[model samples]
Target: MVIQKKVGFISVLFIISMHSWCQQQINLVDKFQNQKIKAVNRSITLYGDQRDAIELNAENSSGIGIIEDLEFEKGIIEIELLGENNPGKSFIGIAFNIQNNDTYEAVYFRPFNFVAEEQIRKEHMVQYIYHPEFTWRKLRSERTGIFEKGIRIPPDPEDWFKVSIHIKENNIEVYVNDLSEPSLIVDRLSSTKSKKIGVWSGYGSSGRFKNLIIK
Candidate 1:
């Protein structure tokens, strides 16, 4: 009886240790593989307890981070974003072909309240635009257009949302929350090739991301 009890305890301990190690491995892979672009100062630390955490500032343009620089011609990219303090005005989403520190094409998801004045009058919805020339003025309509239309993954303010994007030739498809069909698709937009991927956060809002897989 004593021998059996000891063996059972050892087995349980081994399983727990294995599970913890696997989780650490996944986190490490996401950290080392992606190119981090912070709009604010950031830090990654591991304590003696063998646990790790990444910290970032929520203000300024310090909340942006990029995973991969991809080609705009053809391919698919997906990301899982965990939002913190998403109040109604917070914004978190992906940007492509970031030419400079200030410009790129972004597909963003924010609450209806955060919609810009021009966007508010036009349509109360999420946005996807080609921000050419690095200014909001250069925003050109793409797949979804000015009207707000797409799946709304309920904002938990403390939870995460899975966003997936598919770009093939001149067609673009966006999906939120593992829906069967894409929520937004833009047919063609001048046929320009691009290849860059990153994440961004606004002045007061903050977001964290993981499980970024590309194919």
Candidate 2:
């Protein structure tokens, strides 16, 4: 699917197989029982890890493909993802309750800068972005030490990790790998009635997805 938006300066393109890819997507959609998936740019790869799984790579312009049938006003969203070990790039996470291509609250890990030797780079392991209005660039320039932070127990950025987002009415708690504690917590989130689930990656970043269970 091709999503055209006037905002957000980004996009994605599918590589690999088209026929086989369609078959795979069909199986996944059937398995999930939803057709609202915006797997544009042909970047979503699916598999079964004793269950269902998928991978998304941000190709051209900061790729973000939405899952249309899935919507969440308030709940916990869990995603298991693997990040490509690409250098000099940033991002890997979920954009939930998305209003469209230009609007959504995104929280992703800066794998490329996750465990840098430099103290400043290390502090950017975790980041939060509300697109269009609050891109990562603006967040860093305007609100330093507010939207992003380093992980207390840092994991290998390139390796697979599970991120759980606990969303309440106005609050959010982000837990990575560990469910007992949150790596970052926000007292407030941007307001929206969006129910879309997007597999998001920064421009040129690659991410894999699987076992998405909302509770």
Please report the candidate that would top TM-score against the real structure.
2
Q: By summed lDDT, which 10 consecutive residues of candidate 1 come out lowest?
A: 44-53
Could you give candidate 2's per-residue lDDT for residues 146-180 as a string of tens digits?
77887877777767788888888887888888747
Q: What stretches of model 2 exceed 4 Å from their correct place?
A: 1-36, 40-42, 47-52
Whole-model lDDT values for every prediction: 0.53, 0.70
lDDT of 1 by residue, 66-176 (tens): 443233435566777655543454566666665555556666666433323464422433456554432222333432243235353443445666777776777678887
Candidate 2 global lDDT: 0.70
In candidate 2, position 113 carries an lDDT of 69
lDDT winner among the candidates? 2
RMSD of each: 9.7, 15.0
